[model samples]
Target: MNNDHDSSLPEGLDLRALSAFVDGELPPVERAAIEAQLAQQPQAAARVAAWRAQKTALQVLCGASLRNERQAHNESSGGVGQRDVDEPAFIVVRRPTPWWQRVGLAACWLAAGAGLALALGPLAPRLTGGAWNGLGGQPPSFAERADIAYAVYTPERRHPVEVAASEEEHLINWLSKRLNRPLSVPSLQEYGYSLVGGRLLPGEAGPAAQFMYENTSGARLTLYITGISRDETAFRLFRDGNRRTFYWINDRMGYALSGPIAEGKLRAIAIEVCSALGGKPESWQ
Candidate 1:
């Protein structure tokens, strides 16, 4: 409708562009083309419908919270407070958020809402496409992203780590400062894996660390660590596609040990890692 066709777009537009169209980021011509496609494509139509439903849910939740805060502010001032005369009763005036903050807010709603799986199912694959693709909204959680990082960097012939294992002390210090937490490299020597190196990665919450270890057979594993939202001790074994990972949250930090090793072996390594991090197997159980 807007143009004859989008030559750059494939027969079907990508998930990222479709998501942008939903968020009103696409040009009017592109928007019209996507709308036309959605009308003919049932699956694409469903995806757009789901995203709209999620957006409406977030607006409702955000509005309700703002209203509650306004009421509380009024009560605190004895029901007499200065207000924006021109602002509508339903609108709340506050500091403006950047574009990324708006995307992050959508992420918050997805996390807290009951439609998490429904919302994420359609967007998970696009997240692994690259770092820049998922800025329109929350792609997947940190765990899955960490798995993608592993897949991307583990096969390198060289430059596997930004800081080599020989610089262990500096590596520990640097990562701890970036993460704002005391970090210790676990000894995997007993399990036939020696530390090759560690590197810094971008995480959902903030900066993250990835420590790599390799055994005599050239098999490698990584310990991924980052800050979590809350302080809690929880452990679970998760398989993202083919990558087997044992992820846990300890105190304020979250860690995941990932590899293609056997379940028992990975579990053993995870336990040793937990013990080194001042936790026990039963505690995680």
Candidate 2:
């Protein structure tokens, strides 16, 4: 696989190679080659950055569990004792587990305890309570996820979405079935943003959909949709770094419009989207 020169290029680097590079599993020579290619490919570099960010997030979420496990292992086996160098003591150096391996274990632990913390909504305050108050009082998790999805996909020069706008009907139908809800693709052309495409995603409850749109200036926006148990919310704005999302729940469904544009412009676009989808646009005021 390392001998394939074509695979080293941005266009040819497959997901497996990219995963290996993110995991730091590549040899120095192959790693250097991929790095050179990534430097020339902003989209590919963005993907790598996203993966790294995901790993970091997982580590933080599962840090306490990991520490407990490490402590347990240390107790099960006799703890290592310090030795003085002047005594000429023989010290056994045990290599630590790789971060990826530890993170994998933490992921399993998290999966086993998933039900404790579900999607953020009205019930979220009761479930997570003061734990998430620092994030501006139970900020919707789906909207934050939408912001992340937009950041991850909008930088692509090619293959930004799983399906293209040319296959709009098929894309909508497929996503609708997967999400178990009739979905509509809002026409953003009037706002100078045309539909680019969309893809299915894993949501806090079940499947979610993300429809992407791009304007003439190459600026992109995405509308993320998912099912919710209840319908009670006013338009709310969530800011994550440079990205902002205007989101709300209506008719037992949640929608988040995410972009890097100015707050006023994105809110206008989001209000239009809400109105098109039979939502109460007046609530946005």
Candidate 3:
């Protein structure tokens, strides 16, 4: 093998070697080499851990199917007992390779790739410096967290906010102090939404704020705010089912406006809110 390190895997190790090591099929010398590499490389160790986790998950998911297949095979081969004397009952008997596995290492690589995708999710992109938008298996973006918060709190008939809109000043001052930034509530009255209240939320970096608003028809929107290290300002949209969020970064502050509303309407409101909060107009998208 070339053994040159790549973005995804460690030097001197590939999926085949890793899989065989996981299966306890590697010889003593090769296994020792892999063990040494894993001991020295945290990334490689993480990959091995993920593959092991994936194998366990697959065994659980496919247990019944595998049992049925095994039963059929045993019936055709003089009805072998359910368990071997030395080997566990769960172990599949050795036989000719299946069609999928017959394609050689390519199929193994593909299967491992799928397992890796499942194990890493959104974090895989950050790990490999690639682009992936899959959800879960990692902490979500600020906007996605906003979307989850919206879904959680919006349906409540009462107690949707920690502080009611009647005490808007106290809510703003409290959140501002907690967030270490002067926070202000944007007036959405022109868009037929009135402030319902605001609440404190747990953010990835620190405390965050969520300001809720409601229209006469009971439609609700939330504005999520937090301090960010990124100084660049750019507008981006995130959607989950019927909910949508328009998030932007400006002046080291992150803002995400989320609701079950049309995209254009939400974008317009996000722009207006950004402008009100001192974000430059040219940064709106």
Candidate 4:
């Protein structure tokens, strides 16, 4: 075969071994032998040297591309800018907005909003009863929050309560300390419901507690208690779909009993819980 079209590697050195030797990936013995071959064979030495030069050039090209991309990204994000080094850094320019123009813009926006609302008619969203109402710094109502908390944790199986009911005393003590009040667990064993455990949670106004209870049929009820801004003696019953929530505020503390039970049955349980908390459920309106 012609030398240029040999199509075969040098003796004792395959293409893979030569490539590995050029990449410094060979064992010490193999590397020494490859080095000796390169020293003795001009063709093998030239091939290895060409590979090293190509690797260096590739690294330089890739580094330049990455730097260029980064510079472009910084410029687009307003992070990097080209300016004369001797130029003054700070310059002030005034552009005053006329009151009449501002009023005209406001009128245009108002008219567009009104037209949109009229076009949507009955489909328009309610500004008042929304999840986020722009009230004067008022938090969500107790019933809404208790309903959400109940929905979130009632389906839990293994890790329902942060502190299990077996450690009832510790759970109560820990929550009480976190809430800055002497907390008590109302016994529901009379209604076939016993404490499963309780966990400390963040309430709209302050720290809160969710005391979970389960009956013989695996039915769960959560008694959500938190500090309130004012004392409320009257009870209010709120129903959201299948969930019945009986809530009230007493002695600056808000109490809500949430469960999937009927309104009447949950109310009865709420009465017992309210009485335990030094409140009269009969006075609920």
Candidate 5:
């Protein structure tokens, strides 16, 4: 009865279920079900790869920051042999907490302060730029990042991506492992472009993914992705040097396409990718 490895998984494993599989929280039956989905749904596998990359990136960023701070302290204090009165009690500052957070207090007090804090949070942070300025943490610059990545990978001849599209199953499984997002590499054959290949890219968010397709004349386009990030708040067209970028983001993930194609043709390409992606343009804005 099983047609593919993915067919042996639960049923059609949606993004959420795939995420659970990556996180090691899925039970065996459920895990098997997701494996089933992966066998048939390439896009779902790609999403899983993007999500896995995000998890690794998050840990790396956090771990590096911690390690750097400790190293700095050791260097300044002569390997912790000396201490100064002016030195703060803690060697390194932890991630900031916004002013409205009253977690240390009683649960009763937390309820009352939560609403007022969130309401007034932005204004106070902007005004002071102290706790709020560096507080609540900062997100990586997704827009500029997306652009840079688009510019870097679209021009390769020999090694543009890690897993080439010819091995569609391998590409899906590898990316799914790397991204932690269940991905489906939307078929672009109807757009006159067949799959050329896909690559894993490093990004501020994590290992970003790019899938390349080529047309008859060797013209190529790419689909860039990561687990959902806030920068995908709007649908916009971006131009970098001579290349064109058409990008959009949805609830579960984000996508950007870059290439040296005509705008009219590129728009059609983007529309097809978006439709295959199963995203709503309205939510992006």
Candidate 6:
């Protein structure tokens, strides 16, 4: 029985555990195994010792900075525990200070890549949201995002989206929870289109919601959505090839329906959806 992972190792430690061990972040059982392995292999043990020293050095350096800061305030005449008289200073919050500081695309890519690298770690937090950086300093329009999703996903033979419509109840409930809004997949079955499925996509506004439909002839369509800002009010459409993407934002939420069903057929389907959606008050109001 080979319990070993595929990587260079000391006696019995694996790469992942080795990494955790190096960081002093491993669980006790893992730490024990890594230590046992270290003792058995002189070269590996030396490497692990060097990593431990580096980790210790970093902690000490940061600790020294904090100590120096505390010492600079020569106002404390009381004992060590007397510091409780004052509240701890708040750490500076680092919100993205606007991306267009884009000095260069390469630098932008590096920073974005650094963000993505954090996503690979086991301790990585779940991704919550993002904002698009448009060219020339304008914010990227959600409509443009809809158009892109339309072009890339509508022509697909497989994997058009996630959370296919087979799980209708689950899809609706799950997406509704994520968007913090109730969602209805308007029925277009009366107009030759039927529910095909849907996908859960990530978005800047929230969990991007997507639903798909298909007509009897196999033509496909999709609805994409996420909450948006007030400035995004209004309905719009974009086209490329046989595909069309129609998107709109209201006070409550936003939606985009895209597909390759010919214009006339597509319009009819849209009308059905909109009617089921309580008619387009903004466009025809």
lDDT of 3 at 165: 94
Query: Least lDDT summed over 10 consecutive residues: which range in candidate 5?
Result: 133-142
Per residue, candidate 5 scores C-alpha lDDT tens digits across 192-233 of 888887878775568877788888987777788876555334
Residue lDDT tens for model 1, 1-285: 356344554576776788799888999999998888988878778878898898777767556445557768898989965554544346355887899999998988977774665666557657656433232334236667667778888898688889999999999999999998999999999999999989999887899999999999988899999987866565666676668888777786778888989998899999999899887668755
Best prediction by lDDT: 3
By TM-score, the better pick of 1 and 3 is 3
Per the 3 Å backbone cut-off, how many clashing residue pairs does candidate 6 have? 2
Candidate 3: worst 10 consecutive residues by lDDT?
Answer: 131-140
Worst 10 residues of 2 by lDDT: 81-90
Error of 4 at 17 (Å): 70
Model 6 is weakest, by summed lDDT over 10 consecutive residues, at 128-137
Supply every candidate's count of residue pairs whose N, Cα or C atoms clash at under 3 angstroms. Answer: 0, 0, 0, 0, 38, 2
Model 3, residue 192: what's the lDDT? 100
For candidate 2, write residues 1-285 as lDDT tens digits: 455444444676878788899988999999999999999898889889999998877666646335556667777789853333344423346899999999999998897666444444347557665454433465678888888899999999798999999999999999999988888999999989999999988886988999999999999999999988767857788888889899999998999999999999999999899999989989656
Candidate with more favorable, higher TM-score: 4 or 5:
4
Whole-model lDDT values for every prediction:
0.79, 0.83, 0.84, 0.80, 0.70, 0.66
C-alpha lDDT (0 to 100) for residue 199 of candidate 2: 92
Residue 209 CA error for candidate 2 (Å)? 0.3
Q: Which stretches of candidate 1 lie over 4 Å from their true place?
A: 1-140
Residues 1-285, model 3: lDDT tens digits: 555445598667787888899988999999999999999989989989998888877776647446657778998999874753443446455788777767877878899988987777747778866544334433247877888999999999878999999999999999999999998999999999999999999986999999999999999999999887666665777888999998878888888999988999998999999999999857453
Which residue pairs collide, candidate 6? Answer: 162-199, 165-197
Stronger candidate by lDDT (2 vs 5): 2
TM-score of each: 0.52, 0.54, 0.54, 0.52, 0.47, 0.47
